[model samples]
Target: MSADLTHVDTWLFDLDNTLYPVESGFMKQAEARMTQFVAKTTGLPMDEAYELQKTYFRDYGLTLHGLMEHHGVDPDEYHAIFHDISLDALAHDTDLLAALQRLPGRRLIFTNADDRHAERVLERLGLSALFDDVFHIGSFGFLPKPDPAAFDRMVEAHGMAPAATAFFEDSERNLEPAAGLGMTTVLVGAHAQDSHASFVHHRTDKLAPFLATARLKEAA
Candidate 1:
């Protein structure tokens, strides 16, 4: 917000941890499901499955991508199992909702998650109607973020000018590609300060308050 974001006309947000606080335990549920899928598919023990899941995430940016590349897992099957998470721990974030409503211009979700998961998460957070579009993993043909190609596809598909866009993400690595494409990159979550990466234009442990500080552009 203090970084001269007045030129931003398109807001691209990552779902999951970016929208809801990680402390909410919602992602823990999805991660547990991911471990279960890995165990059942690969016949690995629960403990080892958890480790492999983490490795896949570390290497591929998405566990599903690693599974598809190494195990030939079907994308649809993986998505269905991995995202069948309970939202009991997620509370409605009225502050985030208000901030998004205040921001003028196109608002879109750019997530590694599939559309179904994205929609459900937004609906749970009372932000379902606020977004103009969702560019999910399917939209990128299973290529997820941190990959420069994914950023290019999103920009091309949405007809957005990277310089006029601002992307918010929870992962510091993911913001690197956005910055490379000339977009304003804001890192959200507890580890935001841990990153000394020059690519991160802004950092905030709390997204709603950071967004609240955003200055609107005046009419020409």
Candidate 2:
């Protein structure tokens, strides 16, 4: 509340670590699946595939992009293989629910994962009804976050005014594009503190507690 959020009319959130705690192991499973797919597709050992996966992610912003560009892999197949994770380890967080409800505006999910993957995560977290729309990687034609094109597609599709938007994400790199687009960028996660960047307008280790601060300070 003290951060001058009055101008923010749209709440744009990243799906993974931003919406749910990273300890939930949701993304860990997806990462393992990505490594497995790369290993099977390229006939490489698991260790080599995992290293390649990490490299692709770092270089291309998305492993799917690297696979498509270098390996001529089908994006759909990679998506299905990588996102085919079990939601058994995940659970609903009512605290996150209350926190989100307190934030004023049209809330939307902007993620690198496909709709199918995003749906499963939201369903598992029992947050399916909270968001207005999910702008997935498919929606951006496979371009991932941190890419200026991806952010452009989101703004065009949602008719979002970047200056009036507040974007919350776990990745500092991702926040750079959002900041350049004029969004009030908030970095979420413990790893968020491991790096320092001018793009980040706010930093919080927990989404619920930070959002709760907005509500509590309003009531005060």
Candidate 3:
């Protein structure tokens, strides 16, 4: 709606599944890398490592955060191993990139993944230059999202007014705090149906349609 765009001067997008569809198979490879990393780091069996990684992701907002807090794992080492997997499984979506370019105002990436991974993915999509900035888990003292502190730091670092920014993420849980901060929230991809995102302001299965709607609202 027009009301939504009135307060949104900046657009924050999530990387990974939010940028492209999950069907691309990039996530599958990434997940495999994460599982292997967990297995090697924890010295657990592959199956157990997978379960533990999932548990950490479920308990802590991110597996890396949980690994760091409880397992004493090195963040940089973990990130390097976990996110260094091949991105060849991902396909380019030029239409999405074009749609994003047409949107008005500053656009940035706010991802839970480390900056290195974000850069690689964006570059693969031909969208590396489209973003005004990239904020990653490493940006704010390694604190991952769903933590209000991370969002606050992002606001301060970018000199963004809470009411003038819109955050788009695939994870529903991450949207609530941003919404609480007074930013317009857009939940992207299939996870938009997740119950954790009940407070999100908008939901879209694809980025193009959402950007189109936002542009229309801005015009109105």
Question: Which candidate leads the pack in TM-score?
Answer: 1
CA lDDT, every prediction?
0.89, 0.86, 0.82
TM-score between model 3 and native = 0.91
Itemize residue pairs with steric clashes in candidate 1. none
Error of 1 at 182 (Å): 0.1
Question: For each candidate, how many residue pairs have backbone atoms clashing (under 3 Å)?
Answer: 0, 0, 0
Which model, 1 or 3, shows the larger TM-score? Answer: 1
lDDT of 3: 0.82
Cα lDDT of model 2 by residue, 1-220, tens digit? 4456777778999998888878877788888888888898889999999999989999989888888888999888878775556788788888988888887778899999889989988988888988999999999999888899999999999999999899999889999999999999999997877767988998888888787766222321
Error of 1 at 200 (Å): 0.2
Report the error of model 1 at residue 13, Å.
0.2
lDDT of 3 by residue, 36-148 (tens): 88898889999999999999998878889888988899988887875557778777777787777766678999988988889888888889889999999988888888889
Model 2: lDDT to the true structure: 0.86
Model 2, TM vs. native: 0.93
Between candidates 2 and 3, the one scoring higher on TM-score is: 2
Cα TM-score per model: 0.95, 0.93, 0.91
